[model samples]
Target: MSVPFALFTHCGIYEARVQDTFFVADQPLDDGNGNPPAGWGNPYQSGTITVTGQRAVFHDDLGHTVTFHERPGATSFLKLCA
Candidate 1:
């Protein structure tokens, strides 16, 4: 088994990629909170993730899509999830 590649952002979006699976979130990834955000059963659940070189694509089950572009020295727009 391969370890998932994790990407932490300052905006509270924690992402991980393993094979063709992907997980992303805007809050802490956990199940401690019984009331998780809509669509997400857990805080950091996997969704549809796709990567092509420096570009990453995340498609949420809630019809939302997030895209990330990797660049050198790019300032992060996300903050650590509390």
Candidate 2:
């Protein structure tokens, strides 16, 4: 089961598509301040997603990872792609 989704953090927006064993993103992870961390090159890149329970872990190709926690009953203006 593969799911394509978008992720928005304090850093920036990312478009990601899930695969059989992993997921890939269309951009490099940001530093949550709208800038890439030190030693990062190219704004566009790919990554992997690891979902465990209610959390989603994004592992970037640059060796950086970010974890997002699920918020129950959270509301969003964005809609999932059909």
Candidate 3:
């Protein structure tokens, strides 16, 4: 099979690191359906993240914003066979 864009694995993604003009959010950002900010984006390196209620808003320095909310019951399950 080909590679998945989200790159989810057994360890799962735990953080979203931002530096200069780059950013990364390693989590199930939204519902499994097609959505923006579902994984990664560009030109959103430095900015601020505001969390209120069940929503998290990501604003970039370039005047762009991405409101993020994890899907309900979103999780990673691993099954290892020896």
Top candidate when judged by TM-score against the true structure: 2
Predicted candidate 3 versus true structure: per-residue lDDT over 1-82, tens digit per residue:
1111222222222233222222234343433333334333421234566655445556554564554444344343222212
Candidate order by TM-score, decreasing, is: 2, 1, 3
Span of ten consecutive residues with least summed lDDT in model 2: 1-10
Q: How many pairs of residues collide in each model?
A: 4, 0, 0
Each candidate's root-mean-square deviation in Å? 7.9, 8.0, 12.3
Model 1 segments more than 4 A misplaced: 1-11, 14-42, 71-79
User: Would you estimate the TM-scores of all the predictions?
Assistant: 0.40, 0.44, 0.36
Residue range with the least summed lDDT across 10 consecutive positions in model 1: 1-10
Model 3, position 61, has a per-residue lDDT of 47
The true-versus-predicted C-alpha distance at residue 82 of model 3, in Å, is: 26
Report the C-alpha lDDT of model 1 over 1-82, residue by residue, as the tens digit.
2123334332334544444444344334333443334555333534565666656666655664556555434344333345
Looking at model 3, the pairs that clash are: none
